[model samples]
Target: MGKAQKNKTVGRAEMSGVERLGLRVSAMINSPRAQDRCAALIHRMEADQDADWEEVMSRIAETDGVSMVFQDDGGVLLEWEAPTDEDRVLELGEVEALEVEEAPF
Candidate 1:
């Protein structure tokens, strides 16, 4: 018999300003409402153009399902509910496509 596994109920992460910006961009690109706006911003950011970080952070914080807090040291604390078992299963399937390519065939 296998031991029971404990479920994680919440998740937390601390990120630097740049990392938080990337996370916000990822979330926006996945959102139906924000996708169109974020696509242009992504291109500008990637091209080292004038994409303001503060403005980006403010916009993302206003989006639905996003909760953002800025730290005094300019870092970010992100918190969210842990994925349920059903969500975990779907994510695991996606992870299978992300296998590392370091091994020589």
Candidate 2:
């Protein structure tokens, strides 16, 4: 019984970062240039490379505290503990609603 209890906790399913991201991340990422300038620069640098996982991590390490980590399944994660004024979320970013066109008379 003790082993079964322990196993249950250890084997619990977890939500990967991508799964957690889902639809919410779309707005946050495209929040009208709300991304931190430095972070954006880092993102561009990574995008320009053909580097592998280790290389990406190494390049990201050059930045102060920002990091881009990819999950085994290629889910990306960007993390930075430091929050400067520019990084502040002034408001919840919004996604535009779909528009429907009326038939012409």
Candidate 3:
């Protein structure tokens, strides 16, 4: 289970029109058969409706290990990962939401 933190700057009551974001991630290793084990995390942020997943992913990918952030609403933001240095704090410092490429699955 993951712990939820409150952002005093963005009061809970103020989270009215903000849209939720979903983040997907996969580790990249310098190796042969470098298969990226992709996974995703979801965050509910009262952000501008115009914010797109690609834009959010590009912003978050600036850091190491930051995979991606997608918009998952209506409880689609399930599944959480163990906390790490990046996730230690409430805010998703660099990465926020899930990033996944369109592959023929």
**Best-matching candidate per lDDT:** 1
Candidate 1 residue-wise lDDT, 13-99, digit = tens: 556656666775677556665443323223324432234576666666776654565666555444334445765555676788866
lDDT of each: 0.53, 0.50, 0.40
Report the CA-based lDDT of candidate 2 relative to the real structure.
0.50
Clashing pairs in 1: none
Error of 3 at 21 (Å): 1.5
Off by over 4 Å in 3: 1-12, 16-19, 22-38, 41-48, 52-55, 67-105
lDDT of 3 at 45: 41
Pairwise TM-score winner, candidates 2 and 3: 2
Candidate 1, residue 80: lDDT: 38
Clashing pairs in 2: none
* Model 2: lDDT of residue 60: 48
- Candidate 3 accuracy as TM-score: 0.23
**TM per candidate:** 0.31, 0.27, 0.23
Provide the lDDT at 89 for model 1: 54
| Model 1, CA-based lDDT | 0.53
Q: State the lDDT at 102 in candidate 2.
A: 96
**Once model 3 is optimally superposed onto the true structure by TM-score, how far is the C-alpha of residue 78 displaced, in angstroms?**
15
